[model samples]
Target: MELDLLKEAFDRVAKKQKQSSSKTLDIVNQIEKEIEQAITKIQTTSNHTSVLTELKDKLNELAPMNQLDSNQKDINLALAKYTKLLEKCFQPDISRAYRNVDTDPHVLNEIISTHFYRQGLFDLGDCFTNEAREPNAASLKLPFVEMYQILESMRERDLEPALAWAAKNRGPLTQNGSTLELKLHQLQFVEILKKGNRDEALKYARTHLARFAATHKGSIQKLMACLLWAGRLDQSPYTEFTAQAQWEELAHELARQFCGLLGQSYESPLEVAISAGVQGLPTLLKLSTVMAGKKEEWQNMKQLPVALDLGREFQFHSVFVCPVLREPASEENPPMLLPCGHVLSKQSIVKLSKSSTRPFKCPYCPSEATISQCRQLHF
Candidate 1:
């Protein structure tokens, strides 16, 4: 609803701007036409002073200044309304939401350097690390450099590099249930068929795509059917195969697999953190404002006063809600695994054990255990 209002306000401003510009242009054109007529009359009548006076009189009579002022007023009013609407919709002072926390400068620099490398900004990464005196922080650049090279080749519609890399990592890729190799082969087969080479496409499919038939029967069948429409896929039912998005998705998948193999996330860590922070900012800002009087409590808080819904993408790990306490575990009250395989928050276990001085039975089972026997579980 807010977005709709903003869009409507923007439209009003745009409409008013266009109307004002048109009116101003019309007034200027009229003045120009009158001046041209005066110049022509002067050229014919040899009465320069009279022609000048007439042009001035005509321009004043048209009331161009008043017309322009009226148009400007409409646009200004629209702009003012739009500005107020924007200010109401967005909070500009994000600093109120900020909390001071100690961060390792080296770790922060490394993340920034890695983010730049992950983004394929090798020169910028190098420059940053050099300036920061953290050359080792750019160590992650080599793998990303190679990944970018393969992606660059893929962007040019040349899949040889990517195919070779996929072939080299075929075992690991297959172990991970990745069909990147098969997808790459499918793209190659399509490229062959697109060149009006049916025999080559068929032979390529038989050699490259046949191996996946046992597990990917449907996909293999689809690729085999695509051979029937060689050279003119656009006219065939397989026209979607020729879309540019296929290559884009393939590139993304390849990058994901590459990052997975490197024990890294597909998204930059800094990017993910920043995105999640942006999503949670409004809530944090509101909380901060409401707790303005309780600044010390806010500063001492180990967890946010309220839950921030950062969506599924930001949920990197499973959250354990203690059955006994009925609250999610936190760093101060982490989930503990009992011998009976039942998990409960440390706080709940302590309470049940009477501060570890006694044994307590598992809430879900007949098994009992002391707090000393329980192990802290990390997500």
Candidate 2:
């Protein structure tokens, strides 16, 4: 909405300037005509003083110049209004301050430096850590460096490094139900077949792809079919195996697995958070405006009035909101399952429990249970 307003203001200012320019051009043309007439009259007349007097009288009319001046003043007024509007639009940024969440500065710095590390900005991360005296940053560099090396090799269609990394981290990958190892080996096999190395490709597939036969039978069968068109894999029925996009996908998959093994995100969390924050900012600003007089309510509210839908990429996990409290569960107020199998936040459980002494009645059912029976539930 603000952008639209800015665009409208710009257009208005542009139109006003255009009008002023047109008026100035008209005034100049009229003055030139009057000068030409005066020159003609002077060349044709014997009495130069009278001709000059008549030219002066015509010049003194000055209607066109006055109109141009009026137009210019209008333009100036429009510009001033636009400038004031812009100032008003930007004023909220100064007046409205977000309530700080009490996050530790050191932790935030570490997170920011790690974000740089995850993005392969080793030099920048190093500079930041060295300048900030972060000891932990020293250890953070090597792992991401190695991960990037493997990823870079994968991008170059050199799968050896990726295969090695995947093999070394096979246990964790399997635990995460990732098929990156098989996919890497499959990519390697496809490259061999594309190069017309049918014998080597079959041997490699038998040696590596056989292990995943039970889990990826269809994919394995499709890979095997590529052998029939060894010399012309591009024209094969399973031509996707030979496409460069496959290598790209494999590289991304390998990187995702690598990060997953380290208990990190495939995309940088900092980026995701920023994107979500940007998406939610307009809503927050509007809400702030609506609650301008109610500063205490704005500051004290625990939950947002509207949900920010940041799409699938930004959603990392499931969120549970307590029906009774109508507030989302957090670490401090985690979801708890009652003995009767109904769930509510821990704080809600306490409220419903109403003093730890007596048996608490379940809100959903007639079943009664002690506070101890309400176990914390993890999502």
Candidate 3:
């Protein structure tokens, strides 16, 4: 009886193994048949457009054909080859495939879907190591190579140059232009910030947010988003930006949002850190004071980017709305007097105070103190 039972167990195991092997072979055969058919059709094709269409249609039908157990490596290899063929045939138009990943991006841009097939979208700022193993990855080779080296030299805090350049370049990206170029810029910008340039990253974000707001007036979300991004740059663009009327409102809004830490983390270098000369310091102090009142209101209004200039990362930092106060010193330079008890040869407090809303409160202390209560930091 024992001998008979052991023999029966062995027979059962053999049968199971045979069934598994059979299923795998069936799938493998299917894959080979499909690939052979595609290859023959592709070979007979003539026009590049026709070739691309055939390849695209076949991809549409057979793509993600991941069910075939034995065809995994073969399918990957085939896709690599197929993608390469299309790339070579339509050098400029090949990017049109990558366009939807950018062209009609999702509201949140989740970046994953059945529609996403191009491998280039994954090339987010990874340097080309010239891995001869896969020639398939050499998509972004051009003036972008020149720009990448330039960006590597700048400090993390100063990557705006790269983003600005990329944003500007997005305009002419078409059949003749390189989409990879702008893509590299956005990727590099994000990488640099994630590494260290947190402030610049915020600025990059705000600029994009503002540009979006201007384009899609309905997107209040984008407006708040700019505030959130600028909150990261914490460095004041107050003086330079406030020189214009429309920008003044945006600058004030941004400064208020940033000070409150809206849509940002305190540990993220979007800190309250700032640079203030005697003239600039008061504006910051006043801003701080004014913002102390309605902190929650600003926090609730995080802006989102509008669908403006779809491909280009729109980067207008401030919205144009209200007139700003940037009066020059009436007299060349005067013995500076301030309620802050600091003095310099900059300008008189009387005229400077006129630039603010509540000329009643000293910018430094919001105190009702006059020049009598002041001291001179620099004589």
Question: Per-model C-alpha lDDT, please?
Answer: 0.90, 0.83, 0.40
**Stronger candidate by lDDT (1 vs 3):** 1
Which of the numbered candidates is closest to the native, going by highest TM-score?
A: 1
Candidate 2, 136-202: lDDT as tens digits: 8668778899999988887677889888888898988888888888888888888898889999999
What's the distance in Å from true for residue 347, model 1?
A: 7.5
Question: How many clashing residue pairs, candidate 3?
Answer: 16
By summed lDDT, the worst window of 10 consecutive residues in model 1 runs over: 293-302
| Candidates sorted on lDDT, descending | 1, 2, 3
Q: Which candidate is the best by lDDT?
A: 1
TM-score for candidate 3: 0.16
Question: TM-scores of the models, in the given order?
Answer: 0.75, 0.70, 0.16
lDDT of 2 at 100: 54
Clash count of each predicted structure: 0, 0, 16
